[model samples]
Target: MKKRLSLALLPVLMPLLHACTTVGPDYHVPAHAAVHAPQANGPLLGTKHPAVSLAPVPDAWWRLYDDPKLDKLVRESLTANTDLRVAAANLRRAIAMYHEVEADNLPQASVSAATARTQISGESFLMKEKIPVFSIGDVGFSVSYLVDFFGKLERADEAALASAEASQAALDMARVGVVAETVRAYVQGCAATHEYEVAERQLALQERGVDIARKMVAAGRGQPVDALRAQAQAETLRASLPHFKAEQEKAAYRLAVMLGKPPAALPAAEAECHEEPRLRQAIPVGDGAALLKRRPDVRQAERELASATAKIGVATADLYPSVSIGASAGLTGLLSDLGTGQTAHWALGPMLTWNLPTNGVRPRIHRMEAGADAALANFDGVVHKALQETQSALSAYTKELERNLALRAARDNASEAARQNRLLYQAGRAPYLSSLDADRTLAGSDAAVAASDSEVAIDQINLFLALGGGWQNSPDVTK
Candidate 1:
């Protein structure tokens, strides 16, 4: 009898013993991905310039400008930005979903209790005895554990964990974006104010020229047309003032919004800024290897690929049979006999369920394989894009710095020419029109220089953004 009982239990024990046989392919990083190339281990192609250093980028790159106001605004935006709050909530949700999937690895249990009145018919028993109404009571407890003989639950856990990590990376990306944009708005506001001041100075010079031209005409030393020409130039310069003023106001409004405040709430000191922030030292930009590690978009894509790979395993596990072991104990009888030995019952067994091959399991496996292929492609694309953006930003900044140098020189030459022409006119050796023309050229040159200054500041900010340094020191939103 013992031998017979042992044989009887073999069927149930066999599946548990085979629980180590996990189905589907395990995940490995694709060898052909761009991050593995030898070039990625060295300095970036665009870093061979005097304006940038080969040192590792700092976490808070904005501090290189040494602008206390910019640093304060970045910190405030990180804490209060609405987009960051949404990203934080998404991360929390993904973590909760992972926990929900992870719980499936443990046994499931349930308890039930019920009481009801019931009647038995005499005809059903084929006897002349009448059955009286009675009260029935039942209490049950059951536990079931899915024997992961094919690793379905294990794959599910992996996929969920990867998804949670991807969400975390996404939050990091958001922080990077918020920090970059906050810095951008601040720089733009200051740059616009500088341009406005430059334009105002030009307008004042032109107005003074108009007064001198009128005085010369009254003293019979200059033509009425010269005064008219000077007046027209002055009006033209005055007209440009509003546009610069509008740009300053627009930038201030953007900065205010980025800080999570009303547009009108912008500080007077912030709007009064006339000097754009500039870096005193070369910007530190690490290499491609570091960029791959630092950029949150790259991390997010890699995590997504991991999640998709695990999902393929989950789908592949569906091709095999699923096994679950369940045990239950209960008491069910008339209320008067409840809890007695005669009413007690218990059962234990292993259950097997298979979705047969004809039930569309192969197609699901194919779908998952296709999804993994797509994820691999996306990972490659993201890596390439990171490299491209960083290199492009570096090129733009270097070229703009060169352009700014030329503009400053041109402004200086125009200033000298305007001074010489004014001296000649005062000595009665040059026409009023000649001096007037020189002054206009000088005004144009100064405006060009001002605009170039703004562009250079913007380009520097773009390069920092592409380097992806700001998110490293960001506050953890998950806590």
Candidate 2:
């Protein structure tokens, strides 16, 4: 019995100690590029963006929007989005798969039953034999387990665990994206509202100009063509008012949908959207190493990679002999009715299955290796993409800041010029046309400044997405 025990278990136990030696390189996450990583680049005293401002994004970062309406929308979207439901289902599936893999490493027992009724016709074969009716039923439970003389099952379970983690991260990533898009749509809605107001202001000024030109033409001081030109300008400005208002309304509806509501169903604004999204003026992006850790895509990529690495072990295990043992008991009847205890059978011995004689195992090893390679490349791709996202976000935010400064300067100059022109008109030194031109230019500058403010806000939100925004507080959909 001792010898038998040793024979059955020795092969499995030895290989387990060296489970790490399957074939190709064992997986470990590769290092990040040294360009921005201070760990790789060595410490710098007083770096570009201070660590304090570079805090990891907090969960529920949307509260920074300072708009209760936005908070409600994000919460509503999270609960109602169909895509989130799908992600939840996928997570459950991964959990089930993990359970299945874990089960393989434990003892498996199965109970089965079979009943047979047979009738035979024979003439010359058995003339002396009595044509007796017979019936049989068999039932038994068999248990078997192949101890992990190898880490095959363990590795498979590890891979499955990683897969589950990856699924979770993917879900989180989706949540982040959905929330960002909803915020983006809200910002757009708010910008549209501001644009409509600007159009209204312009239209009012154009109407005043038309009245001026009409009076001048009636007094015979201006030609009929001047009245026509002023009327055309007023009509043109009026046309834009309708268009801008329509656009703003559509933006509001889109925001409602993103909040998971019928556009019309959402509460109407007694007041227009007043969202002020506060973000760090100077964006402080962390180094690549830390950045990689924050990215969900990076986490998901690593999980897939671990799974591919484990498949090699699974395929390699198939190359060796698979052994089994079994025992069973049953009953059969002839003259009398015999049910459960009428018959019995049992056996216990090494049942060896050797498939190494075939060349199938080598091909599978190659396939898994190729898969592992692909996964590594994929992981590498995500890393670079995340780096680029962070860099691009910060770079864009910087440009938007500069643009805002330029816009402000232009606005200041335009306001001063319009004031001087109005003074000159009052003093009878400037023609009415000069005053009208100055007013028009000043209005244009004011509108431009409004648009630039919205742009800066929009770009800052984008920076939030790229930097990985977190939820500040869960949105209260009930509100």
Candidate 3:
């Protein structure tokens, strides 16, 4: 009897062994093929600037700055920044969601227990007379699995996995932003401090000039107007010191917030940085192809496009019938006879479900199709924007470098000229006014150089940001 029963079930179980075909269009990375080729008309690589290179970027690009404090701050922020924490949480949520979708591919099993009291009517088939209340107890175990005849589950899993990947890319993007912003704030703080020191020196020199002008006037050798002019110049230079001081304080507060602390809190070393950060080495930014591959936003958009494509397959599979295999084993007897052999019962069979075309089905497919179209467009737009930002950053960085170099030379000449004019005036070979004018020019040149130096560092940071450098250590997502 067992052999015959097993033979009878063979036909019903045969289809379960066959692989189901995946339905609908398979996903391809939209527009990625075009990005692989180097365009001759692409933005010019900065060969003219000695601080620029075509070498591949380092994994820890910030280390190239050679600032240990900066490196430490970046590491700390990576671990504690609120934005990164949020992004990481989102990624975890996506991973959990993916697992939830994947669980649908496995068999579902459940167990249940119940107790009920009921009375049958006198007119019921089991009751020839008035019936009293009766109590019944039951327990059962059931297992069911939806067979993927058209790959609906597979497509759903694919979409879910893609979403997880996109979330990971978003997390990486957040890291890049935080690192860049932290570096910018640190640099700004240092530059502002340096500017303040320079302003103080200029103010002292102007005050000395004012004292000299008053002495000359008291000795009947200089005009009162000259002394007034000297005092006014000293006050003008004094006015700028407060602005730099404010900027310095603001930078410190920004750094504190970026490190995930209160705005008023800051590390002592970071707060006391009074010298501008400088990079002595060239930046190794690889070609445009590598840039396109490295940017997280581009990766995220590509993943989204893939997800939208997978969803179309999921929707398409709904057009076909669904099949499920189910089985149950249970006991049915009087409460006192639950353990007896006579209480055993079992069942197994295939179940089919089909929903005929409804008015809403085609519209739902259309909505999915529209979503896919939007994703494709968005991916294309992201690729183009990434390239644009990279080119723009490169242009700004190179031009700022050139300007910084020019300002350095100009400052040196201005300093020497001021010193010579002062000596010549004291020796009676040049006028006092000439000396004052030279000193004023020197102060302006010094301020310009300081500002340019800060700008160059910021532009360097921007270039790296545009290249998406901070996420190199991130784990690769499984597509």
Please name the candidate that would achieve the greatest TM-score relative to the true structure.
Answer: 1
Against the true structure, candidate 3 has what lDDT? 0.83
Return the top candidate by lDDT: 1
RMSD of model 1, in Å? 2.5
TM-score of each: 0.94, 0.84, 0.90
Model 1 poorest 10 in a row by lDDT: 1-10
- Write the residue-wise lDDT of candidate 3 on 105-179 in tens digits: 999999988777777688867767887777766889999999898899999999999999999999999989998
Tell me which of candidates 1 and 2 scores higher on TM-score.
1
- Residue-by-residue lDDT tens digits, candidate 1, 348-385: 77667788878888898888889889988999899889
Model 1 misplacement above 4 A: 1-9, 12-16, 118-133, 270-272
lDDT of 2 by residue, 346-365 (tens): 44544455686366788888
Q: What local lDDT does model 1 show for residue 443? A: 97
Q: List the residue pairs that clash in candidate 3.
A: none
Give the Cα error of residue 301 in candidate 2, in Å. 0.9
Ranking by lDDT: 1, 3, 2
